[model samples]
Target: MQIWIFSYLHFLWALNKSMIIEWTHKRKNSHYISMIR
Candidate 1:
């Protein structure tokens, strides 16, 4: 049961990390587009 909880937490952390990365990338792209205009 403890192992299952640990793995679940790890999965959540990884998901959060990927979401942050994707959000930052999207923001950077929008900034670039605005600059071009």
Candidate 2:
């Protein structure tokens, strides 16, 4: 039971990390597009 909880939390953390990275990437891309315009 304890191991299962730990793995679940780890999975959430990894998912959150990837989401943050994708959000930042999108933000940077938008910024570049605005600059180009």
Model 1 clash pairs are none
Q: Which candidate wins on TM-score?
A: 2
- Residues 1-37, candidate 2, lDDT per residue (tens digit)? 9999999999999999999999999999999999999
Candidate 1 regions off by >4 Å?
none
Q: List where candidate 2 sits over 4 angstroms from the true fold.
A: none
Predicted structure 1: lDDT = 1.00
How do the predictions measure up, each by TM-score?
0.94, 0.97
Question: Tell me, what's the RMSD of every candidate?
Answer: 0.4, 0.3
Q: What is the C-alpha lDDT of each candidate?
A: 1.00, 1.00
Poorest 10 consecutive residues by lDDT, candidate 2: 1-10
- Worst 10-residue lDDT window, candidate 1: 1-10
